[model samples]
Target: MKTEEVMSYYAHTKIEFNDMFTHRVPATINGMVHHSSTGCCSFVFPLSGQGYFTFDNVRYKLMPGMVLHINNTADIDMKPIGSEGCHYAVIYYDVEETVIAHDPFVISIDDYTTCQRAVEQMMKAFTTPGNISRVQTKAYFMQFISEMLVAHQRSKHVDREDAMSEALAFMRQYYQSGLTVTEVAERFNIERRRFAHLFERYTGINPSNYLIELRIQHAKELMRATDETIASIAEKVGYDDPFYFSRIFKKYTGKAPTAYRQCL
Candidate 1:
């Protein structure tokens, strides 16, 4: 095809991201590593771990910070290159026929940590489409694609952590000041849903639950150590309603604040 003709044909091409998912496939036969499913243009990133990806008879060893772009209508297989297995994310998108990806290609990300964070945000939005506003999800997707496009073009190695230690410090300092998941996440420059997921990954507890635990812990200390009224204690511990705080306290400690105080 002539360059001008090809450009004309693709001028109005549209790309739609659809059916995105994260998967971990074992190295065994049950992993479906060699499965062949055609007609989908997909983007893949190795979130962590190492894997050998095979597409169109070309083999690529993909490690953390690596990305793969597979054109529509190609056969592909990916399995762990090491004994640890593989963990990765993929998005299958539809593009105009004339602009479909033709051959599988690999790209190295320069800022892998940032890209991984974007991918995590995208996956959280993808898996639970309604968890975030549509505009927020769309923004995440656009940023995700833009970052990958830059990396794909430059082929440089870059990576670092998202650095949530500041979040932890902030939570410790503000847990008694009406802390909110959304507020804390925003303070840390992360979307609420993604922050919740990453918080659990780090602390092994839901972020809301963690905040509740903090509140209840402080409430218990005041209940035992001071002559403060239940209502006063509630406000001190970040709850404005004494009755609600008592209810949550009982749920955690199996005794109402007054009852626990009396017993103590």
Candidate 2:
């Protein structure tokens, strides 16, 4: 699911902290253990060691820098992945199901040190003895949720920017190989329309137009440097039909290929 949807769900849903505890287990699981199904959602934050959780038969690896959320829907099994045991904090919270349904999800935290600090503070508050400490613990839990969601959003933004940069570089390098925008998007495993939208937002032009610009610019360079036929130049720049290439050339440069070459 998109980060926006998760943020939206949190924005509209009421979340109340129920309980929290740190669990330490041996390096092996003797048998399957069932997670609490008390109608509250659980968030698992690993502190040390490596393990994996099987939520209704679907497995998810767990370690530091990863946050896992399990709704009250499936039995969860935990097993260590290595010789070392696992230490993790599990926080349970009740969400307003009427506002938005919850699902199991695992998200990686970029600033994991800060997240660990927040978890430590929340646990401290939870263990303190007082009515005020209870309120403070709940407050810390909400702050933790808000910070995690915001941090994830920021991480995703940086990731998208980097991915778009890589995509642009790939397009510029392979533009003359009969490359299509759809093919480029598929190469990066991005959805077609979403890739176009992001490409346009990043480069101030859609990927298709950017590709056309690349081919047209290279064609102009070939015309200036080599005395090749328009058809040959068209093939060099990834166009099959010289007439079709000329039409697109004129559309972009305001002159036909032969006319543009004459001036060059």
RMSD of each: 17.5, 15.0
Of the candidates shown, which would achieve the greatest lDDT relative to the real structure? 2
Task: Look at candidate 2 and tell me the lDDT of residue 152.
Answer: 73
Each prediction's whole-model lDDT (CA): 0.69, 0.78
What's model 2's lDDT at 250?
98
Question: At residue 150, what lDDT does model 1 achieve?
Answer: 63
**Model 2 lDDT-worst window of ten:** 98-107
TM-score of 1: 0.49
RMSD (Cα, Å) of candidate 1? 17.5
**Model 2 lDDT at residue 102:** 49
